[model samples]
Every structure is written in structure tokens, then in C-alpha cells.
Target chain A: MWQALYDEVKNEDFMIIAVAEESRGNETAKEWLDLAKPSYVTLIDREHHVADLYNMVNVPQAVWIDEHGRIVRPAETAGSHDAWRSMNREDMSMPEESTAIAAKAQKTYMDAVRDWAINGTMSKHAFNSAQVRTHLALPTENVALANTNFRLGFYLREHGQVEEGDKFLKIAVDLRPESWNLYRQAMNLREIGPNGFAANEDFFARVDALGAGRYYPPPNIEGFPTEAGFVPVS
Target chain B: MVTVLTEAGATEVVSAQATGDDLWFAKTDVTRATGWNLKPEGLCQGDLCVPVPKANSENFVREETVNIAGFWRLLGRPALHDQAGATWMLGASASDRANALQSLEAPDFKLPDLDGKLHSLSDYRGKRVFLTTWSSW
Candidate 1:
């Protein structure tokens, strides 16, 4: 999907740089990159460096930068919606209605990207500097501290201190509970119990707990859908 | 040995001393771990200098060693470590991050591709970039 969009806008001096935020390192992300066979640049980030720099709390977030290296848009949900929450756990299949909404959401996001790629600063989708700053999730003291603990945790785990690493990882999540990226990545590192289904159930339960919150924050782009079902799960 | 994690990667501060919440390092080790050096004026990096308060100088410096973690706190940056103080991670100050965002410049970072080739965000200057992040988990 990203490759197709890149192909459409590559002629406009536009490039897509996809980063896989995998704590388990290159091997964990290698298979997906190989399967995609992307022509665009694909890098693996083991330390969540990009997430820390961009103040991203979730995955599938994107930032738009212009020719001058200025951010035209701060990190936000790229094209995914929360429709997947409604997927049947047994079959992992989404309902037809949900699938249609998800597809529309993705198309809407892609069209906006194309506009910015072709029109540059003149594009309605491209935000001004002031707007970009307003949208940026500036890190607070706690957020910065959370990042430190996360980095230490990752380092400890990589260096063979799994028990100590888990402690710091837990502290990282506790410091910034709103950061699903931190929470989910930590969960992925934990030793799964014999009941493999426990992890999936825990994830969904957390999603369900966000009764009114969205999993994917609604994009502020013009014409982007914010209908009841389209306001991603938080 | 104290392990200090920075954007440049981890550095082992062999002569570091951890006392309670404070991590003290020799003047040279401070520079080696964090790139900030102590001088007659104050703690400095390049042309930038943060003058240590005359009255509270002891909080940052004691004889030949400087309290590295205290220096970070003095600069309004996060200085974090584990209970054992064996590891430390200094984070960017909130104001620095805010200033960068206010300037609208995308933060530059470098990460390796699957083939171990490094690419920096700044390398793609003079073009439009759609930087996106995802995870398998």
C-alpha cells in the first residue's frame, strides 16, 4: 500500500521512509520488509529513537517534512483506522461494514498525501509552521523520563540482564501510560504464558477499556472522516 | 563501571562513582560520556556554556570530578538511572524539544537498514519526505 503511494508520488521528488519500531532488532523486522519488497528506504529502529524524537505514542504514525526539512505535519495516524477492533478474534476477520470504512479511511488519507506531494506548500493538506507546532506532541518531564527508562531497559535486555530490563520496562510504561508504543513493545518482550491467548486477550481488554477514547487519534486533515465509526479507537 | 547511554550510543565511565542518586565522574570522563566539558567558565560544549552558580558550585563539582547527573538536572534535562546506578540515560530537555518543534525542523536521526547500511533523515534534504513508523507486534 505504501509502495503504491510512493510510486505515484516518486516523480514529484517525494520519498517514503518507512521505519519499523521493533525492539527485538533487525531479525524481527526483516521478514516483513522482505515480504513487502519495498523500493523505498526501510530502516529498523530497535531503541525507539524515532518515537522519542517525534513524540509518537503509537505505531502507524507519520510525519510530513518538506524540501527545506521543515515539518509540515507532526506525527499522527498515517492511514489506519480502529475498525480492526471489531474483527472476529476466532477468525481474525473484519466485518464487511468495518472493512469498507477502513478502506475509505485509508483512501482519504492517501489522497491527502498525494495532494501535499504534488502541490507542496500550496496544498491545502500541508499545514503551516504554526499549525505544525500546535499539532506536535511536545514531551513533558515524565515523557522524557519515560524515554530514558525505555532506552535503559532495551540496553539491559540486549546485554543479557532480562530481569533488570523488565523492571525498567515496567517503569517506562508506568511513567507514560498513554504511550501505547511503550506499553505494547514491553508486552511483546515478556515471556508468553502457556496460554498463548492471554496476551491477545489483554490487548483487546485494554482496547475495550478505552470506551470513549480512540486507538488511532483522528487526523486533522481536511475532509478526513470523523464519523462515529471512523474516529479510531484510542 | 557506570554505563551512560547517549544518542551517540553507550559509553562506559570506568572511573565513575555512584553515590546514592548522584553519579560523579572525572572531568575527562564527563566529556567522554556526555560531550560536555568543565572549564574555568563553567560546563561547556563547543561555544555554548552553562555557568555553574557560584554558591551551588559544589552541587555540580567536587574536586577533580563533576556530578554528571546533577549537571543534567541543572540544565533542565532528564537524568535517569536504575536503583543500582549502574546504568544512566540522559534525555533531551523539554525546552530543547519544544524549541525544535517551534522551529518546525524535523529532528534528524540515523538508523540502519536490513543490510546494515545507515541512513540519516537529513540525508534526504531538498525533497519531500513521508516518514512513517510501524511495528510487527
Candidate 2:
């Protein structure tokens, strides 16, 4: 999705910056990065600095900053149309419900992105200041604690203190069971090699456990006309 | 990776990144190391709320690294980061939640590219930027 966007806007003064929240240029992250070979800029956030900075609770969340450095759009789902449509149950071995969720998210996300690309702030897809502030996730007390515990646990695990790290990690997960990034990272620690996901708790299994109904917080593109296709919203 | 020294003991943290001025730890690491998380109410721990003064609220958080020095300062604890040694000595868990508000701009942070060169948000200040956060796992 980004590659195609990069191509379209290469002539324009637009930059697509991909921040790897937990990867930090590790082997598992590299495997996917190598495959994509993104022409755009890719930065590694080993400690999830970007996630905290943006209050991003999920991967592939996008924040659009205007040329003046103001946030034209707060972080929201930004999946590409191709990714959602290409998910094959037969080929990928994902459950029907998981794929359905992906498809739903990607369609809305891609349409909004494309509109923003063509129309810039004029795109109704972009939220106003009030809307942006209203939509951005406000960290609750539990969220804040969970974020802290997850960070500490992740650091301990990284420095060969698995037992200690797991204690905090468990607290983090238990604090915010819906935080997929935290849950996914914790599960992937025991996983070997640079494989993408494929952990003991697979993505779909976790999603199913969480119930596909609660998998993704609803896309925050409300009031932007969901059925408008690519039409600019004045 | 960076070294963290606490009263309990000295431990190395793999994810802490050092920028020139501040030793930044992710909110996760901050929670792990300091036991404070930025919540809607304030920088909070278990039933404890830390009041962050308004003056010190200027871009205290960059990227996602909470300013250990500033945070400790807010908590009125002495903290130091040895740049040359790449070490951070944390005093104690203070109520370091000064920059806990939601209206702040995303803090400027320098991160490494695939080749290990550092890049800052100021580098792309003039252009429309789409910052996407993701991971393989």
C-alpha cells in the first residue's frame, strides 16, 4: 500500500515513514522488510517509542501530519486495499472471521488514505482539530500501568532476565488484555528464528479467543462518509 | 541497549535509546524501570497519582522516550545519564508524570534507519508525513 502511495506522491512533497514499533531492525522484522523492500523511509523503534508517542495500540496505525507539522489526521487504521482483498483462507490458513475483519478494516482505511492523497486536508477523510483530538486514544489509568509493565518486562526479557521480565509482561497483558502488540510480543519471545508471527499463540487463535467482534476497535473514520468511495468531502 | 542502575541493583536494558540531551525509555520501559505510566488522569501507579507541573510540559516526551532526567526531576529525585558510558542511574520511582496531557505534539525523536544512521522528526519538518507504526510480530 505504501509503496504504491510513495510512487504516486514521489513528485509531491509527501513522505511515508514506516516506524517498526517493537522490531528495532531485528531478524523477524527484517524478514518482512526485506520482502517489501520499501523505497520509503523505515525507522526501527525497538522500545515502542513511536507507539507511546502516538498512543498507537495496534500495528499499521497511521498518523497524517500536514506540511506545517500539525496533525491533520490522528492515528487510525491504514491497511491497504490489496492486503485486505488478498487474504486467502486456503493460502494463508487464517480463519474466515479473521480475514473478514481484515477485509472490513482495509477497505475503509484504503479509501480514506487514497482520498487524503488526492485532496490533502480538503479530503473530508482528514479530521478537523476537534475531531482529531476527540478521536485519539486517551490513555486510562489501567492503560498507563499496562504500558509501563510491558516496557519493563520487555526490557528485562531482552537483557537475559526472562523470569523477571515475564512477571511484568504478565501484568501488562493482564492489565490490558486487548493490547495486541503487547500480547503478540510476549508470545513471540519464546518463538525461534526470524519468522513472522508463527508463535505458540497464533494471531488467529488469539483473535478468536478475544472474539473477532472485539478484534479491532472500530475504524475512527466516522463522519467521513463511509460509502462515498474516493469522493472528496468538501 | 543501555545500562540502568537502581537501588535494588544494576541491570542492562536492551531497548532504551540515548539521544543527546535525555535518556529515553519507552513508556513500557519507564513503567518497568520507574513504575509510572502516562494515564488520562496523570502519571499514575497503583492508586498513586503524580502531579506534573505545567511549565515542565514542553515536549518532555519525544518519540516515546519519557525524559528520565526530566521525569526524575519532576519526582524530585536525582537521576543521571552517563553519555560517555551509556549508562543511566535511576534513583527511585518518583511520581514523574508531568507531561501527561493529551494536547502535546508528538515529541521529536532520533531513530536509526536500516543502516543505523540516526534520523530526527525535524529532518522531515516541512513535508506532509505519514508515520505508520507496525511490527512483524
Candidate 3:
């Protein structure tokens, strides 16, 4: 999907740089990169620095920065295709109703991206300066604390201190339960018994709790004046 | 293990753990851990300098260690140390955020590519950069 976007906007003035938000360079990353062979710059974010800088709480989030280095659009849900989302919830086998609805509501962010890429700031897809500022989430006290805990947890775990790491990791999850990567990475590394970190929740269990529909935050699609036009999880 | 990335694209490493609210770094490693070195000019990092409070000097710099939380307080930045004393994190001060918002400039940060070559947002100042964050899982 990203490859298609790259090919479509390859001649545009702006550059599309994809960041891998994995904790470290792993085999899956290498395999995907090799298979896709993206022509655009593909960078690795072993420390999730971009996530921290952009306030990204989930994967596949895109932030548009204009020529002046100012963020014209804050992080929002982004996907290149809507093929799978076209299916009706009734046709799906997923047990959770919300999950099925969410799956169906996914939108193609590439349309907005293409418009902005071709037209620059004049694109209707681009939000104005004031709007962009309003859209940006201010760093709250809890967010800052959560970020610190995540960093500490990652650092400890990386240095062969699993028990010590889980202590801080649990606090991080408690602080930012919506941030998927925080708990995702933890679950990937451990079995996480009933007393597991993060409110004793695992990945699948939490998703079930959120209902599949609320898993991904709705895309802040450009030109959608009414909230109804936004991605509908229900 | 703590990794500190300065706005100027410098990276510092500090091996310390929080034993409470206090983060203890080795006395010999304080300078390398934080760009600011202990000196008469207060704690200096490049041209940026912050004066060490006379009252908190002892707590800031112990016999062979530095209390990162205390030192960060002196520098006017926010910091946190884990309960296990196994990790620490520091964030920009309120003033820093205000300045960035006022100037409308994205904060500069450096991250390495797959090959470990560093890339700074400042490096792409003249070009429009689309940064997308994704995960395999």
C-alpha cells in the first residue's frame, strides 16, 4: 500500500519517509522491506523516538509537516487502502461486534495525502495554522510521566533486567492504556500471567475489552466538517 | 541505562537507577551522562549554562555521584525516576515547549536509520517531510 502511494506521489515536491517503530531491527522488518523494496527512504526507529516526538499512541499514524518544518497536520489514523474495510460486519466472523464495525470503518488516508502532496498548503486536505495548533494535543502531566516510565522500562528490559523493567512498564501501561505499543511490546516479550502488567490485561484481552471497533482511533479526515463524516466505529 | 538526546543532536548515556525520587549516576559518569559538566561556570553544556543553586549543591553533586532529579530541577527541566531505581527519563521544561510553539518550529531530534546513520528533523528544514509511524504487529 505504501509502495503504491510512493509510486503515485514519487514526482511530488515533498518526500515520504516511512519509519519503523519497532523496538529494534527484527527479522520481520527485514523481510517486509525486502519484499516491498520501497523506493522512498525507509528509516528504523528502534527507540520509538518518532512516536514520542509526534505523540503517536498507535501504529500507522501519519503527521504532515510543511516546508517550514511546522506540523500542518497532527498525527491521525492513516491507511493506504480500504479494500478489507469494505466488507459488511454481518459477513465477518469476529466475535466482537465493535471490532467488526471498526474494521469496516477504516478509510483511505492516501486520498487526502495525495491532494495535499500535489497542492501543497493550498490543498483542501491541509488544515490551517490555527486548526493545526488546536488539533495538537498538549502534553499533560500523566502523559509526561507515562513517557518517562516507558523509557525506563525499555531501557531496563534492553539491559537484561526483566523484573526491574516490568515494574516501570506496568506504571507506563497504567498511565497510557490507549498507547498500544507500550503493552504490545511487553506482551511480545513475556507470557504475562494473570497478575501481568497493565491492569492484568493482555493484547487480545484488551482489544476484546475495547471491542474491535474502538481499537483504532478514527481518522481525522480532512474536509470533514461534521463528526459524522469521520470514521464510524459503530 | 538512560539515553539522553539533546536538542543539539548530541546523545548521552547514563547508567543509573532510581532508588526512590532520587536518580543516582556515577560521579565519574555524570559529565558524559548529561552534557552539562560540573564547573565553576555552573553546569555548562556548550554555550548553554545553568547556575547551580548554592543550597542544593551537596544534593546535586554528592561525593562521587549526581542526583539527576536535583540537577534537572536546577536546570528547570522535568524528570522522573522509577521506583526500582532501574530507569530515569527527562523531558523539556515548560519554557522549552512555549518557545517551540511560539516559533512554530518542530523540536529537533535525532534517530538512526536501519543502518544506524543518524537523521535529524533539522536536517530536512528546507524540504517538506512526511513522517509516518508504523509497526509490524
Candidate 4:
């Protein structure tokens, strides 16, 4: 857990940056950061500008920025190799005792970290310029459109002026209707905003159309796309 | 030199339209209910020429699952695809193709800490700050 890591690394020369338009007042984020005692920076982005800036499509994705403000690594929890991956197919399909592959991956990554901490740049796990570049590209056009609309819709519902964000959000629904985040956004927009767009039939129609016969909402929230247009079918 | 991502069903080549800078982008007539960007493959919006597979190759991607990493790969005109309901994503062919989504930054913001004081990025201008986001879910 990050709390554990914070206990370990919180006092070093480096600082901690918690990204999220996560908390509103100090009690939530500040309390934790203070408890950890690291020079911490708690940030919020209801508009997902950071997500857009770093191309972070997932939560807890992180990039290490060196002292000069240059990125040491693109944002992702490569550090999380220590943690068990939650969405393993084996776990999803059959969870009795098939963690063999997962264990191997964990050990490999752990060993890699030890190597990096000891020798730094000499570690094989350390990414080079080319490797890092290969890993930091954004989504394609279709995906980009989905991403753009989903984000636009999110901001519109949460912060921006009404109506315009919803229009784009509807297209997002049409694009990736399986996206729960998008669907949730649309619903929430209707629930809260100045638009007061009614819980229209068109919205449900979009959700129905998303998965069509196959779009099954994953039981685990983390496994689903946190984008627009995806409605939970049940 | 544009690239397109699409929900290219078995018959079509892409699902979504094409989007990028302007290098590989132009225009196309492939329009349906499926969402698509309107860019081309192999032209730089700047100096980047994102490629997209025309027909068959594009269908393969459309037929597959779309993940964050998968979407990032399909940036330029490199390759594309779509499925019936699943989101369509393309694969970028730029040798410099990096996964952009994984490296995004947290936006600048000012929120009151557990205390009543509002904290801003400007407050840390001269300092080195590391912010981490923790989630119970």
C-alpha cells in the first residue's frame, strides 16, 4: 500500500505528490500527507487536466519527475509490480490457486527494483529514452475521440458551463457506451447540473446500444473504463 | 498521413474516424452511427505521421477489446479497428510512439487541506513537490 511506502520513503529528500481532484478540505488529504510526514503536494483536478496532460487514462498511474522537472518515467504504477494485479484473467475465471504467473511477475519486478535502487541507471528495468517514449504515446483517433468526449463531458458536468459538455457526452455514449464513467457522468449531469436535462429515453437508448448483446459491466469497478457513455446494465 | 480508429466491423476497415494533428489527416466519406475521427494516415499533424490500416488490418483491432494501453498504441495512421459495441482504438506506428496516457500530470489546483486553508500550486513554486493520490476504491 502507498501508506506503507510513505512510511518508508516519506522522509527522504524527495516529496510526495498525490494527484486527484481527490479531496476538498485539508482533513481528508492533508491529514494523510501530514501523518506520512513527507514534503507532500496534494492536488485536485475536477476537469482532468492532469489526466489530459499526462495522458493518464487510469487512476494511480504515476510518472516520476526528476528534480529539474523532467519526467523520470511516464505516469504508471510500474512500482505496483510489487502489488498483485487485480484484473488477472485467472483470478476472474478461476480463483482457487493459480497465482503462479502473478507470483513470477511480482518477483521479477521486485528484483528489478532492488537492482535499480542499488545501481540506479545500470538496472535493466530502468527505461531508456527510446523505451520511455514508446510507452508514453496517447490514444488513437477513435480512442482519442472517446477520451476527449469523456473528459469533456466530465468537466462539463462537474465544472464547465452546461449543455455543451452533454452534447459531446452523448457522442461519447455513442462511441463507447460500455464505459460506466461516461454513463455515470451523463446520469450525474442530469441529476445535478443547471442543464437539468431530463432522464431522457435517449440516454437509456444509448446505454442499451453500448454493449448491445455483449457489453457486460464488470463486477469490479476498477476493471471498467472510467469514461463517458458506459451505463451499468443492472 | 493520417490515422483512424474505428469500430470497424468485419466488413469495414475502421470503427471511429481519424484524429491527430494535421500531418496524416484529410477527410473521408466513411460515416455511420459508429463514432470515427476524420483524419488520414501517414501525415504529420506536426512532424508525426500516424498511420492507420486501411481495411482488413483495421478490422482486427475493431474486433478486439479496447484498453488504455491499446488505445495509446493506435495514435497515428499506423493501424485501426472496431467491434460491434466495444470501443474502437488504433495503434500508432510512429517509431517515437510512446504511451501518452500513462504519463499524464495532475493538474494545478487549490483545495483546502484538512484545515481551512486553501493550498495552491503557486505556493510551491520554489519547492519540489510530490503529490500522490490514494483511493479506497
Candidate 5:
């Protein structure tokens, strides 16, 4: 999807930098990159450095930077929706209506990106500096501490200290529960489930625990859907 | 041996001393682990110097060693460690991160592509960038 967009605007002095926030290292990220064969720049991030620097709490987040290296948009959910929460657990099937809404939300987001790419600062989607700053999600003290613990945990685990690594990984999650990237990555690295079903169950349960909160908070942009079109299951 | 994690990567502070929660490093190791050098004026990284508070100078500096964690706390940055203090990770101060965002300048970073080729965000200057992140997990 990003590749297609990048192709459309590559000649307009627009570049797409896709970073894989995979701590398991290059091989894991390389497989997907090879499959896509994206023409744009693709990089592997084992340290979650980009996430830490940008204060991103989830995957598929994006930031917009103008030609002069100024941020026109801070990190936000990039064309993703929480419609997956409405999927049928037994069949792993999504309702057609939910799928359509999800597709529409994604298209809306992509269109906004295309607008910004072509029109640059003149685009309505391109936020001014003040608006960009307002949208920026600066890390809190706990979030910063969580990032530290997350890095330490990953480092220790990579160095063959599983038990000690898990300790800090758990602490990282506790320090910043809002960071799904930290929580999910920890679960992934630890191989929390013996099988896919157990992992799915755990993920579903966490989503359920959100209550009224969104799994993917809709991006605050013009024409963006404000709701996931379904009330989250309590 | 104490391992200090910074943006420049991990450094083993062989001469580090751990007292309870604090990790003290030789003045030389301070510059090795972190870019900041301990000069007579205070701790400095490049031209940015943060002076040790006169009232609590002992908290940051003690003879030939400086409390690495204390220096981070003094600068309002997060300094974290394990129970044994064998490993430590220093995080940027909230104010510093926030200030960068407030300035609206995209924080530049260098990362490696699949082929091991490195690319810095600044390398794409004069071009609009759509910087996005994903995970295979």
C-alpha cells in the first residue's frame, strides 16, 4: 500500500521511509521487505529506536516531515482502524460492513497522505508547526522509564539472559500499560503462547480490557472517522 | 563490570562501582559510556554544559568518580538499572524530547536497511518524507 503511494509521488520530491520495528532482527523484517520489494527506503530497527524517539505506542504509526525537515504531523495511527475488534472469534471472520468501513478509513488516510505529498504545505492535511506540536505525543516520565526498561530487557534477552530479561520486560509493561508496542513485543519475544489460539485469546482479552477505549485511536484529521463503527466489547 | 546503554550503544564500565542503586564511574568512563565529559565547570556534551548544583555537588561528583545515575537525575533524564545494577539504560529527558517536538524539527536518526546499508533521516533533506513504522510480529 505504501509502495503504491510512494510510486505515485516519488517524482514530486516525496520519499517514504518504512521502518520495521522488529526486535528479533533483520531476518524477520527482511522476509516481508523481500516479499514486497518496495522501491522506497526500508530499514530494520531492532532497538525500537524510532519508536522511542517518536514516542509511538503502537505499530503502523506515521510522522510527516516536510522538505525542510520540519514535522508537519506527529506520530499517529497510519491508516489503521479498530474494526478488527468486531471480528468473529470462532471463525476469525470480519463482518462485511466492518470490513468496508475499515477499507474506507484506510483510503481516507491514504488520500490525506497523497494530498500532503502533492500539495506540500498548501495541503489542508499538512498541519502547521503549532498544530504539529499540539498533536505530538511526548513521552511522560513513566513512558521514558518504560522505554529504558524495554531496551534493557531486549538487550539482556539478546545476550542469553532470558529470566533476567523477562523481569525488565514485565517492568516495562507495568511502567507504561498504554504502550501496546512494548506489551505486544514483550509477549512476542517471550513466546507467551504455546500456540496461535492462546496468543489470539490473550490479544482479544487485552482488547476487551480496554472497555470504552479504542485499540487504535482514530487519527484526528479532517474526514477521518471518529469511531470504529462498533462499540467495543466490555 | 557495569554495562551502560546509550544512543551510541552499550559500554562496559570495568571500573564502575555500584553502591545500592547508584552506579559510580571513573571520570574517564563517564565520557566513554556517555558522550558527556566531566570538566571542572560541570558535565558537558559538546558545547552544552550542565553545571553541578553547588549545594549538592557531592551528589554528582565524588573525588575521581562521578555518580552516573546521579548525573542523569540531576539533568532530569531517566537513569534506570536492574536490581544488581549490572546493566543500565539512560533515557533522554522529557523536556528535551518535548522541546524537539515543539520546535517541529523532525528528530533525525540513522538506521540500517536489509542490505546493511545505513540511511539517515537527514539524508532525505529537501524531500517530503512519509516516515512510517511496522512490525512483523
Candidate 6:
């Protein structure tokens, strides 16, 4: 867990730069950050410019850039080695078909991160060279298109154009039927009419576990609490 | 879940089309960025809120005329008008288009430690920061 690692490293003198494009203070997220008491810096990237540099498509992405600022290695989804079930996975029950497939995917992803971290460029998992080509090949053309659509949808939503956002969201969902987050985002915005406000602010903010008002308030509208003594209008 | 807190509360959900101060479209002024309480009580869905007056019985009604024009100018929210009325929605006040990875980055955020000083990403420039975000199973 990056948090666990951050906690371990923050006490030292390491300056951790966490770039986030979303607002923080989700109830639970705040709680954990509090508990960790990290000494490093966490940056918010509302525009996600930093993420563009790292070529990151998701959170928990990491790249070990040396002091010279050169990426010692390409980006990776950081995970602890011990987090894996084990390289020598034996027979496991095929619970539900979906769960079984998920298990397999999880193993592959975990193994990749562990191997990459442990060996670095030399690690068998590093796909920087020819040997890595087989496993580390980039996404195909279709997959790339899907990613683009999803991105466009996000832009539309954050820009307050839900219908346009939904068009891309729909394309993304059709492309990656298995992506949970993508599906979740699309589903949330699908029914949001041009006139409808995202009422799910309660749902999403709570999903992040931050007890707060909706994530983004209507642009420029400032609402505050009235004086307590004054009688409320009916 | 519904509550009948007051007998005189108006239930009609008025959609404001920003035209002018008097008959100004409501949409012209109110935005998602400021807060959408719908109710006069100022109880927005998330952490953000707009201060409005309300009684226990009519939390969702507009008890007072919002200074729509003032907010329109102050916040600079986008506005749209047609022959009949004008409409406005919050602009992307913060983030724009993002990828899964980009969106993964929560906005730059720091909170007061037990000591109460604000903290930020610059605080940890030299050291490696590993921020692990997780969900409860």
C-alpha cells in the first residue's frame, strides 16, 4: 500500500510528491491521511498536468525518477511485494466465473509490479527491452481509442457538459466492459440531463468517505450558513 | 424518504433562466461550483454549501431572493440565453479532461496537522512520496 510506504518513508527525510487532480477531504481519505501523518508533500492537479508527464492513467501510479529527474524506470502501479499471493500460485477455487478471472488478472498485475520494483531495469518484468516486448507491448489501436473516449467524457463532465460527456462515457463503457471505475462514471452521468444537477454528490463524496457537501458546487454560487438566531423562512 | 416539516412550504421546483435581476434566469446565477442546495437551508449535498435562509418546514424552497446578479458577476459563472430565457451551468472551475491515471490524482490538497499549519506537495520535494489510495472491502 502506498500509504503504508508513505508512512514508513515520511518519518525519514524523503520528500514525497503526490499529485492529485481531485479534491481531497473525502471523510475516510482524510482520516487515513491524518493517521499516517506523512511529512512529505501532496500536490493536487485539478488539471492533471503532472499526470500527463508520467503517462499515468490512474492513481497509485509511480515512477522512480532519480535525483537527476530522469525516470529511472517507466511508470508503474506501486504495490508491495508481500501484497502478492505468491509467485507459485497453486490450484485455487474457481468461485464465480468473474471472480476467478479477476483473481488471475490481479495476480498478473501484482507480479508485474513486484518484479519490476525488485529487479529494476534488469528485472525480468521490465519491458524496456526485446525480451519485455512480448508482455509489455502498449495498448492496441482499439484500446487506445477507448482510452481517448473515456478521457473526453471526463472533460465534458468536469466542464459541465454532461450530455457530451456521456457520449464519450458511453463509448468507453462499450469498449471496456470490465472497467469498474469507467462503468461507474458513465452510469452516474448517463442519466444526468442537461438540466439535472449531479445529485450523486452525496454518493460520490461519501464513496471517498469525506463528509462534505457535493464535490464541485455550481460554478460561482456561494452558499453559506445564515445566522443562527434569525428565524428561517418557510 | 420524505418529510412534511411545514404546511405552508411551496413544493414547486423553480428553474431559473438567467435573463435579468428581476426576471433573471435562475440558471444564470446558480452553479455547481458555488453549491446547489435546492433548499433555502444551505444544506448542499457535499462539503460545499451556499448560505441561504430557510425554515425547518421549507428547507428546499427559495425563502429569499438570491442576489443572483451579484453572484453572476462575482463568481464569473458562464451564462447562456435564448430568445425566451437564458441558461448557465458551472464551468470546469477546476479540472478539465483527464485520463483514469490523471483523475487518479486527487486535487492538490493539504490539511492542518495536529499542529494546525497548512501543508502541500512542495514540502516533500526531495524525498520519494508513495501515496497509496485504497477502498474498504
Which predicted model would earn the best TM-score?
5
> What tens-digit string does per-residue lDDT give for candidate 5 at B1-137?
99899878999999998887678998888887898999888988888888888998887788898988888887888787777788888878767777777888899899999988999999999999999999877
Chain A TM-score of model 6 comes to 0.44
C-alpha local distance difference test of each model: 0.84, 0.63, 0.63, 0.40, 0.84, 0.37
Across B1-137, the per-residue lDDT of candidate 4 in tens digits comes to 11233222222333333333111211232333223433445322445443444554342233322222222345433232222222223322322223333333323445444434567544553333444444211
Give the lowest summed-lDDT range of ten residues in model 1 chain A: A191-200
Off by over 4 Å in 3: A79-108, A191-201, A208-217, A220-234, B1-20, B23-31, B37-57, B61-66, B73-103
A16-53: candidate 1 lDDT, tens digit per residue: 89998888777568777878899999999999999988
Model 5 regions lying over 4 Å from their true place: A192-199
Compose the digit string of candidate 5's lDDT tens values, residues A29-94.
777877899999998888888998898988899999999999998999998888767778777789
TM-score of chain A of each: 0.91, 0.77, 0.76, 0.52, 0.93, 0.44
**In candidate 3, what are the lDDT values of residues B4-122, reduced to their tens digit?**
43333334445564656767677666676665676676667788777766776777666766776677766667576545443456665545554454455666677766667877777
Candidate 1, residue A214: lDDT: 69
Off by over 4 Å in 4: A21-39, A77-124, A141-152, A158-167, A173-234, B1-137
Q: On residues A1-234, what C-alpha lDDT tens digit does candidate 2 reach at each position?
A: 578867865546677889887633556677778889999889887756666556667787888887767777766666622223224434555446545655665766766766776677788877777877777666555665566666656666666777776777788778777676677777666554244563443555554454323334456665322331121212
For DockQ, candidate 3 versus 5, the one ahead is: 5
Stretch of 10 with least lDDT, candidate 4 chain B: B20-29
Candidate 5 has an lDDT of 0.84
lDDT of candidate 2 at residue A56, scale 0 to 100: 66
Query: How close is candidate 6 at the interface, in terms of C-alpha RMSD after superposing the true interface residues?
Result: 10.2
lDDT of 6: 0.37
DockQ each candidate and list the results. 0.70, 0.29, 0.46, 0.11, 0.71, 0.06
Model 4 docking category: incorrect
Using lDDT as the measure, the top candidate is 5
Residue B129 error for model 6, in Å? Answer: 5.8
lDDT of 6 by residue, A101-195 (tens): 33444455445444433444554443332322222213333344444455545654665766766676677667654332344435434553222
Rank by DockQ (best first) = 5, 1, 3, 2, 4, 6
